[model samples]
Target chain A: MPLKLFELVGRDAARPFSPYCWRTRMALAHKGLSADTIPWRFTEKSVLVPYGSERVPVMLDGDRAVVDSWAIANHLEDAYPDRQSLFGGAGGRAMARFINSWGDIAILGGISPLVLADIPKLLDQVDADYFRTSREARFGKPLEEVMATRDQAVIGFRRSLEPLRQTLKAQPFIGGDAPDYADYIVFGGFQWARVVSPFKLLEETDSVYAWRERLLDAFDGLARKSPGFPV
Target chain B: MPLKLFELVGRDAARPFSPYCWRTRMALAHKGLSADTIPWRFTEKSVLVPYGSERVPVMLDGDRAVVDSWAIANHLEDAYPDRQSLFGGAGGRAMARFINSWGDIAILGGISPLVLADIPKLLDQVDADYFRTSREARFGKPLEEVMATRDQAVIGFRRSLEPLRQTLKAQPFIGGDAPDYADYIVFGGFQWARVVSPFKLLEETDSVYAWRERLLDAFDGLARKSPGFPV
Candidate 1:
């Protein structure tokens, strides 16, 4: 019996092509666990309201409801310990946990502001002008005027990458040697920036750029292609 | 030989006294491991930077530098199976993971704006006011103004609590039988909020309030208290 995975369709919902969601998908693929993919529409998160968490990449194994990507990934690994897991050994497990934490605190916070850079186009696809109106109302400024605040946000985002950049320069991946939770996390997040963002921030970090390419190639045929979620 | 545990502490750094940090602390306490708490000032995170993550609650077991809380907790549980883990069995483990996810996303996000409500007072305690200044400047509004925008955040936070409220209504804690990771996550977060904000938001949820009172009494003799950092 395959696991059930729910993801939001389209490029990105709250944050486009969220690396967070992709990490779980990658783990499922890595584990060779075929999941019944449930494509979700952002506008109707009510479908998931019963689970009590309004987040994407929720996995249901039997009746178990796992919301966070790392948690879902952890569940997958534990449920099927013999398969290839992001947390394979003692070190790998630690690496996986660390990477997941980094994704939550550092990676997500770093890239979130840029979603506003192309808010008009991003919102147009959703058929909701609420983001524009909300920005205007909240900032008491025009969409463009509020978006003007993104440059400094970009700088701050770039600076947050310094620790990762320095760390990656020391090793091939965050977990050293084999790809673990760290790889999936950094990959999933950076891939969102790599694939979806109008900004090409990964180019600034050559090792990260190379790492992204490697992950894409490694997961090539087995990888769930673009718009991995249901439409 | 006893299991060696590491924690970076300070007056109130980013990694200081967070629910994430306390999760590891409680786990350590449960394991009968007396940890060597390294007090780190905000500027001196450099001491642990070589271990890779700048975050506090980084646990070093031998040479293994486990940087994230979830990872640290898992490491402890996996390494010491005899110890009573918050993750009891597979089912219990899954539930704990779900609750932990809720803490990071909905619970923390819901509580953060309120936490920053007294930024001016927090600024008085810390020698450097850069974080507070930057946070205030980013909000582009007073703490009162930002807090006024919190109706939805409050709603979401409270909604997240409903399941635990329903569960705890029947039991003394979230994990049905005893206090586990779920209880720890819920208790630490709400405890932090109970001290920081006057709003007894959790009070409306009856069973949860009774559970909270019982939990408050559970820690009566423990020296550790969550002082809402820098205040």
Candidate 2:
């Protein structure tokens, strides 16, 4: 059986937008493998219940089921050892965990408030309601209120990218001379923001902007070709 | 010729406090290598002028001069490839750069204000004058004023450490399973703080605090043996 990946999407199934899913998507491309994309909506937890996970980016590799983006990335690397290595080496694998944590907290968490309101617009009525209600409870405010200060909050968001910016100043990618799982780890957050929101998360002059553009152009413009706002 | 390292110190010659220098110090130990430490004070620019750089952690491996902690690390890795690998591989080498950047900006930068005033107390008269003048110029305020809000500002510093904390939650070290350059990169900042200040950077309950303790015990308590304030 062909590998199948449950990807988070909204009204437009073509635009899979979960940051975690994007991480797995980029990892699959890096490994020179392809999976049949199963567009999964936010409110559709029942679809993943059988897989023992409520998250998208759940990968079914023949008989085995893999859940979580990090686990899926590790699974892809181990299962497809002959393909291009997702992690350059064991050291890279360990350090990538730190990058993953930073990406989740600094990148994903930072971008959430900036794009929270824009997200519901991309969802259908039911998914939008679910998204807003769940997110509002998490933020302790309505989506609109959460995003009310985004224009100013985005400044902090951009400032938080200083480590990435400083790193890019010395090397072309986080994986140094070439893009690796570490790059994918961070790019996933940007790709998620681009797919859902029109708000500019990065300035045109920012090195991070150029880095994102390069990733968008990677794999024959795979990410850029995907349906998303022009960020 | 034996390896020589210029280590930043204040009044006490045995106590090296610069975060970048601590990174090199730990990297050297990780490689099972030793260096003759040349204690450097803040006002001692003339001492480094012969090395063609004005920084601590300037390493002289024979006639070759390596400046910057990162450069010194790369130099050590390349020159002593047979030793335990500082970077596990090329991929690790690349990603460690990101960790290095995060260590500098997030960890070191976050701790600076909290410990800024305490630093001068560790310096001699001339060095303290140089430190205050130079640091005040950069911060655009008196060091005391900068540190005045630290009791409150340390909360932000702890929050900024969430990435490291989260990573440590899953792995024993940033290098995973064992300490490596990535661990040294972050531990350097904490070590720097420990050397110069009694300020509590991490609560005893934090996983990061535990991680620091493990590092302190690494290389047979090399870091713990060094002269520093009890943190």
Lowest summed lDDT across 10 adjacent residues in model 1 chain B is found at: B222-231
What overall lDDT goes with each candidate model?
A: 0.59, 0.93
Residues B8-38 of candidate 1 have per-residue lDDT tens digits of: 3333443333456666766676566666666
What's the lDDT of the predicted structure labeled candidate 2? 0.93
Residues A152-189 of candidate 1 have per-residue lDDT tens digits of 77666666555455555545555455455556776776
Error of 2 at A123 (Å): 1.5
lDDT of model 1 at residue B68? 77
RMSD of each: 10.9, 0.9
lDDT of 2 at B45: 90
- Residue pairs clashing in model 2 are none
User: Pick by lDDT: which candidate is best?
Assistant: 2
Candidate 2 chain A: worst-modelled 10 consecutive residues by lDDT: A48-57
Q: How well docked is model 1, in DockQ terms?
A: 0.04
Fraction of real interface contacts that model 2 preserves:
0.88
lDDT, candidate 1, at A183:
67
